[model samples]
Target: MSIGQSVSKHRFACVTAVCAIAAACGSFALGVGRSIWFDEGYTLIVESQPFARMMDLLKVDVHPPLYYLLLRMWISVFGSDVMALRAMS
Candidate 1:
């Protein structure tokens, strides 16, 4: 292969690698920031409540009961780490 062709191939490879790395970085950043929201904090609090009593608290909350119910189920499937919990949200 000519030198020019080799150079072009190297440039393409570099661009592809950079794009992949950038996408991975962006996903990780979003994952890290996922736990930094008010609703997440509220979810954490509600999830800590006794299973039998959570329904009463949900009755008075601002959002729909469906979200709280889904969150409760999610927490059961995945243990309640803030990051893990937020990832499911």
Candidate 2:
């Protein structure tokens, strides 16, 4: 009820709001701007094939088929949305 108390409450509310906004923005930026590196690129390349082809390729390829198969299914469900792709990562 006092002026000083009101001012302190207002300042605290502003600081809390600003901090929440900043944390959200930072998470968004980190998720959106992150780049896929070599392993991710290779996963995409392998998973982009049809299942039969992917299986055949898996025979000769060195990496596990499970991850690539999961990626393929994920892409099938979500298409190429960057957020979905990043979530898979």
Candidate 3:
């Protein structure tokens, strides 16, 4: 590809990134104020549990703990409040 084509691609990528950020900010701002969806509620509950208990719960649902472990760390720092949980995602 030529220099001009490469530069154009970079510009498009940057613009897309900016627009995506803007859209996420707008959507999540309102989302935090709203009630959690079923899965989001379940996530909060699962991640808040003690690790051993959390593992048992995950087994019933047949999910890996990787994501929940990360989320548990995130919640420990930011909290499990709707706003905090929504922000991490």
Candidate 4:
């Protein structure tokens, strides 16, 4: 409503955005290039397959297929590089 209030709100938003971006960057930097764990390794294997095959495998596997399906699409757009894959999270 008031000029001071608006400026304060804008400054708060900017600070929040900057903090969020910095946190994400720091998290990604720490995780990037790290060795894939068992679950992520499974994701890599499942996501690399054909859609139908991935689905079929999921039928017998314990985990759901939704994440793998999305990962498949992500890999299609971004390639299978480790950093790119981890960043997709």
TM-score, model 1 to reference:
0.56
Q: Pull out the clashing pairs in model 2.
A: none
Between candidates 2 and 3, name the one with more favorable lDDT.
3
Best by TM-score: 4
Task: Give the clashing residue pairs of candidate 3, or none.
Answer: none
lDDT of 3 at 28: 79
Better of 2 and 3 by TM-score: 3
Judging by lDDT, tell me the better candidate of 2 and 4.
4
Off by over 4 Å in 1: 1-27, 33-36
Every model: Cα RMSD to truth: 6.9, 7.3, 2.6, 1.7
lDDT of each: 0.78, 0.79, 0.86, 0.83
Task: Give the TM-score ranking, best first.
Answer: 4, 3, 1, 2
Write the residue-wise lDDT of candidate 3 on 1-89 in tens digits: 99999999999999999999999989777886588888889998888788899998999786777889889889889888888887777
Total clashing pairs in model 2: 0
**For residue 2, what is the lDDT in candidate 2?**
100
| Residues 1-89 of candidate 1: C-alpha lDDT, one tens digit per residue | 99999999999999999999997777667877454578777788887888767777877887777877787788788877776675566
Q: Which stretches of candidate 4 lie over 4 Å from their true place?
A: none
User: Which of the numbered candidates is closest to the native, going by highest lDDT?
Assistant: 3
lDDT string for model 4 (1-89, tens) is 99999999999999999999998999888886688778777788888788788888899988777778788888889998777778777
Model 3 vs truth, CA RMSD:
2.6
